[model samples]
Target: MSPEFYTISQVADILSVSKETLRRWDNNGTLIPERDDGNNYRLYHKSQLEQFEQAQLLFQSNWNDELNIKASRPYKMLELFAGAGGLALGMEKAGLESVLLNELDKHACNTLRENRPDWNVVEGDISNIDFSEYHNEIDVLTGGFPCQAFSYAGKKLGFEDTRGTLFFEFARAVKETNPKVFLAENVRGLLNHEDGRTLETICDVIDDLGYKLVNPRVLKAIFYQVPQKRERLFLVGIRKDLISNSEFDWPSPYHRIMTMKDALKAGELYDCDVPNSEGQKYPKRKAEILAKVPQGGYWRDLPDDLQREYMMKSYFLGGGKTGMARRLSWDEPSLTLTCSPAQKQTERCHPEETRPLTVREYARIQTFPDNWKFSGPISAQYKQIGNAVPVNLAFAVGRSIIKTLNIIEKNTAMNKKKCA
Candidate 1:
């Protein structure tokens, strides 16, 4: 049977707050826990937690209320920088058909083609491709283009001024396809990249291309059912003509946060425990040192001598450097994954095991289904999965996009009837 009460740490993880915050809340009488037999340990009854906003999501009854939006008719999407099909898979689950997917990486292209043989997987440089043939043929054009700084000659940047960057190519596709809507996903850093001028220029370029840019929002992946604390900034643009009629809404957050357990174990997110697969191993000395670090701890948790030895001169340096020698806790979300999980500065060690997260485990954290086969060498596979937009997060956003398209479709049909 499920436990009747939760410890302070358990409640903190469930609410995604630090223990200190819980202590403050306890002092404030916002959420007071009962003392155990010895009057030492604080225990929270499960029923009391139900009153908080975050805890409400954990209830099955609450999940049922979230909108189950669907595509009214077949909608087509063209994806760029489509790595290992994470976003594509989510969009597919959300009922959007992929007409064409472009990726410069050979391995990623092969992975896409291998999984969905019917998808038009375009391989090689995006700059060489001409998208005019797809003009007005697609419903959405989406990409997670790499953020690059534009060479501003101190002039007001416009559509043509962003020519040298990959974003320009993305914008070019938007212009050529003339999709009813388009989405661009990038790292949260893009919001303040080059002191926010890059994003400002992107907005201006979107306007020049005859698209109305929505106020971009940074979406926290953990809030969207992904068991990783990844943040992605999304910019949605609607074609200028459709802007007046379109009503676009961001996807709602999932009721409760998913934990590492949800990703790897047989739970709501998956039907089976994660299958064993290849993963990187730590060196003997490193493994010995890490064994001493507790789950949910980093290098700082090591003994003073070991800390100095393991961290070297960097130990004297400042900042938390929390990812180093870090081990995940089963109850909390995993850290944002990187291209290499075993790297010293950003280790993603398994919660109970000494080694790094396995290839399949890595994929699981990113919300890729068990059957989504990744191509190329193991390292390439890791890179592809690491670089992907979390599949579930993408699905949530895709559902919102579909809902907006449905409204647009209904309005268009109504206008046609009026003309008749």
Candidate 2:
């Protein structure tokens, strides 16, 4: 039978709150949990959760049905900053064909080329390349360009003003290719970057280029089959002429939040147990200290002296340095992966092991296929995986975009028949 009572971790997933927040609620007598007789673990009865609207939504979700999405026809796409093909691979799984991809990193390019030999991988700086040849031939243009501010200088934003930034190169590609649609992916901080001037200028530039900007959304990867708490901001735009016929919809969330158990084990997400691979090991003293941390525990879980010894000056600093000496919990999603697993500020220790996550483990957490290999040193591989969009998250977005494009295709065909 499915679960009637949920653990604190499971409830956190449904309610979208941290365990610490839930604990606070417990302390305040907001919602008390019934203790499990077997192990004295806290378990919230299902009846206690109906008060939360988010919990109710999970009860009535239709994620399995949403997976029926498919393309009506082959839609061509072009990409910039295509690192390790994460977004492109996900889009392909959703039925979009990549005509070309541009990247400055030779390693990421090699990884792409090695995986998909037929893909047209162009390795170079975006500004040095020309996208004019693909004009009108491409259906969509996508880029995860770096977030950089364009100086406002008390003037209205325009295409010419974005010249010095990578976003400008992305805009230049959109202007050159005139794709039916385009997407610019960035960190969620972009929404508030420069006190929101950056996004405002981006909107103004989209207007100048003859596209209608959909309200951008910062999509949480965990909601879209990724077993990590990563968020990426996606800005979807449609050409002005097709705006009337286009009906874009964001992908529906899965019924349940995926956890680390689902990711690393041979469960619903994968067919086999995670393969043994090379990973970074902690020094003897560091490993001994980290081993004291229980699953889901961080520096605060340590003894006072160990905490002081490990955190050093950081222990006295303000703000919850939760990521320090952290050990992931199997029952919860992994924290967002970073460029290197051993980074002190963003440590991602294994649940039961005292080592940094392996490269393959990092790839698995990012929702990359087990077979997909990175072509670089271990550190470089981590960098590529860390910077990638979660493949399943991209698949969800790609399917939604394809659904919109299918409507545009049918509407255009009907119009052509009427003209004939």
The candidate that wins on lDDT is: 2
Give the candidate number with the greatest TM-score. 2
RMSD of each: 2.8, 1.6
Consecutive 10-residue window with the lowest summed lDDT within model 1: 58-67
Residue 196 CA error for candidate 2 (Å)? 0.7
Model 1, backbone clash pairs (residues 3+ apart or across chains), number: 1
Runs off by more than 4 Å, candidate 1: 1-67
**Tens-digit per-residue lDDT, 288-376, candidate 1:** 99999998899989999999999999999999898999999997789999999999999999999899999999999999999899999
Residue pairs in clash, model 1:
57-255
lDDT, candidate 1, at 337 = 98
lDDT of 2 at 285: 92
Question: How do the residues 30-127 of candidate 2 rate in per-residue lDDT, one tens digit apiece?
Answer: 98888878898888988899999878866666667768978898999999999999999999998899999999999999999999999999999888
Error of 2 at 77 (Å): 0.9
In candidate 1, how many Å is residue 395 off? 0.5
lDDT of each: 0.89, 0.90
